[model samples]
Target: MRARGLALKPYWSALQSSIVSGDDRMLFPPFGNFLVLPSVSPLYVPEDAKPSQEDLQAARGVIMSEAQAFAAEIRSAFVANLVEAHNGARTLDSPLEDVDKLMRLVTSAVPCPSGAYCSTSATFPAILDHFKVCSSAALTASSVSTSPMRVLAIQRVLAAVNEVEPGKVDAAKTLTAELYALGNEAFHCEACLPQQAAVGPAAWSNAHSTKMGWTKMVHHLLVRHTMLGQTLPTVIYTPLKPPSDSGDAAATAETASGGFVVEDAES
Candidate 1:
């Protein structure tokens, strides 16, 4: 089931290759190592519960079906947004200025005092990195007029942000929904224009505006959090495993950092 889920998208493969090669500096905190699941959700499985084979199979089927649907939606949204942005009269540039300002605010914000969980310190830096990457990829894609890389890049930023602080930025969530719907509608509607003519100026404009608004909302949240000196649950960071030693592989054991391993969470 895990293999099938990974096979649903090419981004996973690209990310894996990048991780293995150590080619991208921004690919921090490693991909598969970070597994986040909602603490309270219907998907939770009891540790002692023993499900029958039929029940397990049913769950697997449902999960796979949902994964397939999500993959399809992502592809559709990418194509729709790409076409509209590329063909529209105005250029689709990311809000780099806003991102830079946010980064500055984060840098100046007070660090978490001795034993508090600094949510801002944990999530904001990595998110800013993602924002820069997303902006660069979007610009490159726009120049080529053929890539859907921007969509995946933006999605990465959104997913990372959502993971750390879900529901904090309602505007971001709305933008994501709008993008998904725009693509789904384009795919299902017969009245939709042909590839070249499918560029909906109004649709693209609205999405662009929403994206900008979402960024500002995120910035505002960071400002507020910093001012209040708020903190979230502390997250313990585990160090990565060392490479296998041909002879004495047992000698290469992982060690705790500073006698205790605690670092900011990265997504």
Candidate 2:
């Protein structure tokens, strides 16, 4: 049995090379985001077990829809950033910091080859491995096979990270679209198997017996409560309105007394 019930084979090669150097090249593969939507591995699925044409098309549709949703969110964020700049306020940095903190929580929850929050090559891989195992185990227990929809949910999370990049303010919108495209390609490739099992123990035990057993075993880990003990602070937004100018206040008082009425400058 693997230590802590977490299997580390899928990332063995990558983890090994980075272990001594403490690099994260293996943990955060080349594509981009890891949590929301990880870069799809072309070698994950085999040619003989490829998903059907119909499934591939369906996956494409789902990925595209997710791309659109991701785009809208990024657009909204961009607008908010612009408004903040115009009004002399800091744009989304505080929120971004909160997100990074949350990410740290997730990354540090598992027993990593390197210490939690340390600068080590194995650190990033540990985080990715943590997510993969947790997510896989969660789905397997419910008898729900990992599908394209799950893929979209994972990809959507990358937006949080993108929003905070030093010079990549617009990265959320752009990367979201790219993720969709990359996802479409990844899912359609021979490596990704189409989801077939329904949720429930019966389906998992009967129809998906072989796959579920292996899948769950490969990704299962018994995490301790201490690993997830941190509490997130609550954020509240209170809108502030600029005070009325002295000239505007005088006009308002005069109008109340029926002495004068304010008019638009153009009018």
Residue pairs with colliding backbones in model 2 are: 22-120, 22-121, 23-121, 36-154, 36-155, 37-154, 37-155, 45-191
TM-score of every candidate:
0.21, 0.19
Off by over 4 Å in 2: 1-49, 89-267
Tens-place lDDT per residue, model 2, 87-128, is 332223454433323222211121222222321111112333
Cand. 1 Cα-lDDT: 0.28
Which residue pairs clash within candidate 1?
A: none
lDDT value, residue 201 of candidate 1: 54
Displacement of residue 47 (Cα, Å) in model 2 is: 12
